[model samples]
Target: MISKVIAILLYLAVVMYLGYKGWKTTQRPTDYMLAGRRMSPWVMALSYGATFVSTSAIVGFGGAAGLFGFPLLWLTFLTIFVGVFIAMVGFGKRTRRMGLSLNSHTFPELLGRRYRSSFIQRFAGGIIFLFIPIYAAAVLIGISRILEISLGVPYEAALVFMTLLLAAYVITGGLKAVMYTDAFQALIMGMMMLMLLGGTYYMLGGVTEAHSTLASMAHLMPSKLQLGGMEGWTQGARFGTPLWLVIYTTIVYGVGIGVLAQPQLAVRFMTVHSDRELNRAVLVGGIFIPIMTGVAFTVGALSNAVFMEKFGKISIAMAAGNMDKIIPLYIEKIMPPWFAGLFLLGMFAAAMSTLSSQYHVGGTSLSRDIWENIKGREASVAASRFGVAATVLAALIWAWVLPPSVIARATAFFFGLCAASFLPAYLLGLYWKRMTKGAAVISMVGGFATSMFWLLFVHLKEAKVIGLSKALFGVDSLASLAPKGSAMWLMQWVDPNVIALPVAMLLAVGAAYATQTMQREHVELCFENIR
Candidate 1:
């Protein structure tokens, strides 16, 4: 316990030092919000990796990997190719150049300036402010669970403690602190994941043997999963099964394409000095992203084999039917006490790094984009600081009150929502000069409405939780009446993003063509500074 306490304290000291450095260097709104738009390639890359892959990936999605198996590797592929490379090469350069041209500091500001409407800024900010806490709560729950198991801390107390710690640095240092600390956190996360991957294989004899053993246990899949379309942990769900739709559509595609639309991640593109930095970032991001996500999925699924052989039970069963608890239980029961302490710090680092960004983004969305812009007030770092405090409290309340299962679902929900709401407007704004103000507004509102409608009426989790379907329509889902067990019902398992993103794209293009376009001069000026 003493060693564990010491380890945690050491980690905190390092994070605080980074926070202090960011605080001292920050001078203007640009510095506070974007680190003066001069961050180095390594810091930006690692920071992006850390913020992108969080406890949601490690704990939430890792747990899913344990249940669903190697199929989740598809997500890692998307993270590298689409999330990192395409996002940086295809989008990052222009976003940075255009952002500077518009003098935009926040993502909402970027879209707002592009369309010349304060409403777009406030609406984008409003969406982020309203929905991001649910995702932040998910991250908080992930680390708090680990803390409960490893440090003997009560879950609620751990949640609050972690939230406050993140609040301290982010409220003080803003994005500078968030990125600096994220770089450090990313290093810890990378090392810890490597150790875990190596340790898991060692315990199971070798990598090949471990994988073979897991593959052999396909017949042992739970009855519930099998009915829901699961074939096995190793084989993944069969085609056309409910679970297959959940894994392939909801989990994979929802998060995969959604990365392109993330406000927090997109804003990081504007934080760097030049396209050269983003180019350099891709190399680091390509390697760092895989280590973070790949290792988690591999270890998570194999954990089932490790636990089954050592204790005669699968990880999910060992975790008492909660997938969220699988990773924490695996660390505690499999790894040495010292390594457990180290990994705990790693988990805290992952959660804190991501949560700090979420809180900061949410706060800035409210203060910088919505509140200040609507009221014609100047951008104030102090207003953002106060917004950070409120955002943390909101996340704490969500973490305390929500179910553990919400950790993963909340993440997907926010991702899908952001993709639906922002993807069309963002992509069109960057690449299309013809994109008009009317088109951007209609696309954003249409996408947001469709996504929320699907979630509230069609998605099982929210529908079941909100009880709107049962109360209002006398069904479990909006599709509950759609020819039971047909493809439409299978669609019920699909993420709203699948439907919502396309609607947004079509609306954006259709509306743009229908309405008068931005002036040619304006269009050329948007990219004038880039070349």
Candidate 2:
């Protein structure tokens, strides 16, 4: 524990100092929000990867591995193939040129200018303000969990400390700080995990023994561990997490493809001086993301070998509703105190790297996108600073109210929401000449509503406002069919993305097409920027 405390403190000092250095570079809104438009390709790629991986990849997705098994590896492929490769060659260069041409600051600004629709700016900005919290809160949840496990801190206190630390660099230096610290933080994440690879193998006897034990656990998957124990299990199996095709294409692909639409990430394009730099960054991102997320996912999943071998069962939760503790629990038990400290620092890097990006994004969405847009010009310093304060305060309030149990799904919920709401419109506006302002708005609205309805009414909602089986068909839920068989019934399954996203896309395109004839100005503006 002493070692863990020292590790975190040292890591924090280094990160905060980097933040201080970044602060020296900010003199204008562009510098604060877009790093003075002078970032190199390596910084750009690391910044993109930092926000992409985050605490979600570690605590949330890592726990998913412990829960689901090995198929989630599909994300690594989608992330690399679609996210980095396509973004650098196709989206990144185009967006950088187009954004400079339009002098756009935020994503919605670019879209609004491109499509000649003020509504797109406001609507996308609103979504950024709203759905982004779920993702940000997920980072807080992961950070809180790690802190609690390592230092015996309460989840609430851990959350406060973590969120505050994140807000420090974010509110002060904005994008410059986020990118610089992400570069540094990404490095920490890599080093710590590299160290853990050694510690993990030594503890588990070796790589061969580790795989043997995990295989044994796969065989021993208790009924509780199968596809029907949790309410989600049956649904996951019914549609198979939809990943055989949909998850990779929609949820994962949507994210990789959707990076173009991400306001915070898109802003990175505006900062780099040249397309050549963006191309250089792609190589960096390719090397980094695979190491950080790929390594964590592998170790977190394979650690189950040690888990089952030692405890006779794999338990991701050290306690009820405390999923964040899973990785920390395994690390503390499986590694020496000093190594556990390093692991904790790595975990902190994962959280901070993502949190800093979120704070930068949230503050800019509120300040630059929303506040400045309505006035028809740039915002005042007081206004930007006020936005910074409000963003931090809002995150702090959420951290205070968040319960342990709600954290995990909230993380997934946010990512899915982003994919649904922004991906279609942003991508179309970028790549499709015919993509109209009408189409952009329709897609955003459709994706947002579909994802929300699913989470509240179908997936996470306990009340079952309209029974899934009954709503889609005449059959009842699994509860109704339980007596007839083992209750892993067909109608029992519900995949929210499958149900919601497609509906939203259909709504978006249909509405846009119907309205396109009247919105030529909007369509022309989008056309001017798309290439």
Candidate 3:
């Protein structure tokens, strides 16, 4: 108890100190928005990595791995290659140059200025401010569950405590504070996961022996999962199975591809000074992402081995079928109390770092993008602070109101929405000189409408959860024609992104060609800083 208390106090002190430094340094919108465009490559890399891998990865997807097996590692690879490498190299360099040239601070502001359309900025901001609370609530639920199970804190208390702590720093210091603290949190998270990986292997005998043991237990898969097409906890589901489609498309492709359009992650590129920093960041990001995600996925899959050895039962049975509690139960059972405390602190850091960024982005979207642009009012730091408070309240309500298992789906929902709404416009705006404002609007509106329609009417699980299908259509899903056992029967099992992203991309190309071209001067300005 003493060691845990001391560790938590020390962590809090460091975070508070960094928050103070950020508040002291921030004077103008540029400092609060983009850290004055002078952040170190290391800070940017770590901040981006930390923001990307949160409780959603650790608790939510880790829980998925505990059920689905090692196929989740494919997402780890996609996060590093597509989320970090492609995002930074292909997008970051151009984003930084273009953001600076356009005097844009936020992601929505970038698009607004790029196309010279205030509607684009306000529309993007409205979408972000509206949907991000659901994602933030998911993160809040993750940490709250951990604290409730591991530390004996009430879930409501944990949610409130974390919200207050995050609000303090973000309202005071904005993005500078968020990134500085994120870098620090990333270090703690890395250290904890590395310790966990080594500890997991040590407990399960040698690496090869432990994996072989897990592979041998393939037949122990639950009847529920087996019926859905899962083969085992180690070998993954049989391809073309309903469970396989869900794991690959909804879980992997949905979240993986969605990272390309994430507003919170995208804005980090604009915080650095040059492409050289982005290049330097690649190595750090490469290492950090793998340790955070790869280790979590591996450990999640191997947890069954640990449980069977110690408790004579599988991980799912040990946790009473609550996948969310598997990791917390494992950590408590496997690690010493003192070390568990340290790991809990790491969990706290992971949750807070991500929440702070979400709240900051959502708040800035409301105050800077919507109010200032749409309402024809000047954006102010005070207004942004108010927006942050509003975001926190909204997230708290969601965390308190929603049922369990929302952690992973809420994340996928936001990612898919962003990909559908923003990816086409963002990609074309950066690379194509002839892309017009009308095409961008068509792409954004059409994608947003299609994706939301899919979620509310087509995605059966989400539709049921939201209760719209039951109330309006009197069915679980709109297209409920398939027989349960056949592959085509539950076809809506796939994520909307698989369908929505391609639709958005096609509309962008076809609409741009069909519309009038951008003015020559507008085209010249689009390519100004890059050229």
Candidate 4:
């Protein structure tokens, strides 16, 4: 306990010092919002990777891997290739150039300026301000779980403690503090993950032996999961089964595709100076992402083997069926006691790094996009700080109210929603000169509406929990009314992104063709910095 407390205090000291440094450096709104647009490539890469792979990746989705098995590794691949490589190379270059060309500070502002429509900014900002709390809650739950296991702190206390700590730095230092502290935190996280991976493999007698043992334990899969079509940790779920849809559509496809449109992530692209920085960041981000996510998923899947060997029960069974507890419980029970304190620090870093960015984006969206447009003036720095505090409070409330074992599902929900709502407009706006303001408006509103409609009315997992379909239509999902064996019935298991993203893209294209294009001069100005 003394060791844990000392480590935490020392970590907090470094973090606060960095936050103070950021505050000292910050002078203008640009400094606060974009770190004066002069961050180093290493800092940018580590900050982006740390923010992208948070407690959501390590604790929430890692826990899901405990239940779903090795197939979750596909997400690691996507996060590296699509999230890092394609995002930085394809989208990051354009976003940075265009953001500078337009002097846009926030993601919504970029969209608004790109199309010369303040309404676009306000609407996009409102969406992010309102919905991001749920995603923030997922990260909150992850670190809170870690604290509960590692420190024996009450869950409620952990939630409040983390919120206050993050608010202190993020509100004071803004993006500079977020990125500075993120780079530091990323180093801690990487070291701890390397240790975790090596220790797990060594404990299980080596990679080949561990995987072989897990594969042979297929029959030990919980009856419910087996019925849901999970074949084994190594073999993956049966094709086209209910579990298969949840794993592929929600976990893999939804999150994989969704990373392209995350507001918090997109804003980071605008933080660096040139495409050269982004080019350098690609290699750093590529390596960092795999270390964070690959280790988490591998250790999560292998935890089942470790637990079964030691405790005579599967991972979820040992955690008493709470998937969210699997990873934390594994670390607490299986790893050395000294390692637990270090792991707690690492998880704390992960949670704080992500939460700070979420709070920053949420605050900027409110102040820079919504409030500024509403008042027809620039909001004060004090106002932005107020918005950050408000975001922290909202996420804390969500963390308290959200159901247990919801971390992974909530993360995926937000990711999929962002993909559906923003990906169409954001992606096309970057390249297609012909994309009209009307098309962007239609696609953004239409995509968000469709995603929400499906979540509340069609998708069984969310609909059942949200219960709006039950309240209105007396069914858990609208698809429940269809013949059980039919295609419509299967729609219940499909993710909202599968339905909404395509709908959004189609809306964007169709509306683009139907509407008048932006004036040629404005289009040329927007594309001036592009090759």
Candidate 5:
């Protein structure tokens, strides 16, 4: 107990110290907004990677892997390739050059200036304001959940704890603090996962033994384990039918690709000192994301072997279901108390690093995007800080009371929304010459509406009112037909990302062309930024 307290206190001190240091260096909007455009590529890479892998990945995804099995492992590869790869090759250099030229301080500013439309800025900000809080809440809820389960802290207290800690650094130092601390947290997180992975492996008697052991157990290995197991087409056909495949594909590749266009991330491209730094970030980000994400997948699955060998019962809640907790659970069992405390701190690291960015981005959107749009530019720094604090507070409170079922899905929903609303317009705005102002709006509206439609009426649990076994299915009321089933029968292709994103893309292009001849000054301005 004393060790745990010590660990927590020590962590708080280090986190605060870092925030204090960053705050000491920051003075103006440029430092707060873009870190003075001088961040190292490696630092940028770590911060980005750390930001992406939040408590949602640790807890919600950990739980997801537990419930869904291994097919989602595809996310590890997709994150590295699309998240980092496309960011560098497709969007990074151009964004950096363009942002620097325009003196843009925020994502919407860049997009707005690029397109020369305050309308686009308003549109983007509105979407971010509407959706990002849900995702931010998911991160907070996930962190609080872990604290509630692991340390026996009260949920509300845990939420408050997370809120206060994140708020201190972000309000004081802004993006500079976020990046510095993110890099440090990323290093700790990387080490902690490595330790957890090693510990799980050593405890479970290594791979050959684990496989041999799982081979003998019931449901340990999926039925098709031998035939490339679930690694085959099972995910796309079975779990990922029309409804989920779209979700899965869109969530994985769609969101991943969309990273290239993110205002928060795009700012990083512009902030770095040189193209050389961005190139170096690619190597650091590419290698690090997989190591961390792959560890989550591997440890999540391996939990089965660990549990069967030790207790003869299944308990994957730590990993969410499969073995997400394989890391946490392993730390509790194998490491000494002090080391366990240290290892668990890694969870704290993941939770804080990711949450800080979300809060920062969301707050920036609120202050810069919404406030600036309505009040005009020249919103004060004090106003920005106040916005950041309020955004964090609002999200923290909401996380405490969110419905149990909704908590896990919140991050996915935001990712889905972003994919729907931003991905189509953002992507085309960067790469497609034919992309018009009308088209961007159409894509944004179409994707946004379709994704929401799929989530609320078409794909919800209510839709499953009628099931194969009458008792098992629940019926949905809002659709053309009252759909019902145990997912297998219908509503399977309900993943908003797959369905909504493509629709948005199609609409954006069509709309852009439909109004092609009606060229606006704003639209022409965007083309000039990149050129």
Candidate 6:
């Protein structure tokens, strides 16, 4: 216990030093928001990767992997190919160039400036400021679970402690602090993940042996999951079943494609100097993302095998049905005692790295994007700092109220919401001069409304929890009104992104054609300096 405390203190001391460095260096709004647009490629890559793959990815989604098994690995493929490769190479350069040209500090500001619409910026920022806390709660739950299991800390105490600790640096030092700390945290996460993978495989025998053992445990799957369409840990989920739709549509497809439009992740592109920096960061991101996500999913599934071998139960069963607890319980029960402390530190890094960015973005959205736009002037740094504190408080409240096993679902909900709300306009704004302000406005509003409506009334996971549909129509989801085992009933399992994104894209295209184009001069300004 003493050694763990010492390790934590030392880790925090280093993090504070980095935070102090960022505080000392920040002399302007650009420095606070964009790191003066001169951050190193390596720092940017690690920060971006770390911020992208939070404790939610490792602990929350990893726990989901424990339930769903190897099919979750498909998400790893998307993290590498789409999240890193396409994000950095295809979208990064364009976003960076355009952000630079327009002097946009936040994601919403980028859209607002590109289309010359303050309303667009304010609306996007409003969505982020409000919905981001739910996502932040997912990450908070992940690390709090780790602390609760590993260090025997009370979950509520851990939540409050982490929220206050993060607010200290993030509220004061801004994006530079977030990125510098993220890079440091990324290194810790990478080393710990590598160790975890190796340790898990070694405990279960060689890689082939581990997989084969897990594969052989197929028939041991819970009857509930089997009925929901799950096949086994090694074999993928059965096609077109309820579990299949949840895994593929919500977890795999929703999060996979939704990553492209994450405000926190997208803003990182603006922190670098040039397209070359983005290109160089791509390789680092490519390597880092696969290691982080791949190991988590692999170990998560293999944990089922390990638990069944030792405790005579599956991973979820061992966790007592709370998927959020699976990874933490596995680490506490299966791994070496010493490893528990290190893994806790890694999770702290993961959670804080992501949360810092989320808070920073959330704060800026409030101060720079929404409030300033409302006031018709630039918001002071003090206001932005206060915004960060407010955001931290909001997230803490959400963490307290959110249910168990909600980490992965909350994350996917936020991701799908952002993709539906922002992707259509943001993507088209970067490349298509014909995309008008009217189209961007309509698409953003239309997408956000559609996504929320579906979440409240149609998507079973959320509708059941929120009880809005139940209150309004006496059903958990509107889809529940359909005949049992009918095609319409399956709509309850389908992710909002599967339905909302295409509708948003169509709205964006149709609205663009129906509206007049932006001024030629402004369009040229947005595209200037592009190669």
Best-matching candidate per lDDT: 4
Model 3 misplacement above 4 A: 483-488
The candidates, ranked best first by TM-score, are: 4, 6, 1, 3, 5, 2
Question: What's the TM for model 6?
Answer: 0.99
* Tens digit per residue, CA lDDT, model 4, 404-508: 899899999999999999999999999999999999999999999999999999999999999999999999999989998688998999999999999999999
**Cα distance off (Å), candidate 6, residue 521:** 1.0
Q: What's the true lDDT of residue 16 in model 4?
A: 99
Q: After best superposition, candidate 6 residue 74: deviation in angstroms?
A: 0.5
Off by over 4 Å in 4: none
Assess every candidate by TM-score.
0.99, 0.87, 0.98, 0.99, 0.87, 0.99
CA error at residue 341 for candidate 3, angstroms: 1.5
Q: Which residue pairs clash within candidate 2?
A: 114-525, 114-526, 442-508
Model 2 lDDT vs. the true structure?
A: 0.68
**Candidate 3 C-alpha error for residue 475, in Å:** 1.0
**CA lDDT of each prediction against the hidden true structure:** 0.91, 0.68, 0.89, 0.94, 0.69, 0.93
Candidate 4, residue 173: how far the Cα is off, in Å: 0.6
Model 1 misplaced stretches (Cα beyond 4 Å): none
Model 4 — which ten-residue stretch has the worst lDDT?
378-387
Over 58-176, each residue of candidate 5 has an lDDT whose tens digit, in order, gives: 66665555434455577877788777888776778777766776777888777776666678778787777656767788778776766765687887998888888789889879889
Which model is ahead, 2 or 3, in terms of lDDT?
3
lDDT, residue 6, candidate 1: 94
* Clash count, candidate 1: 0
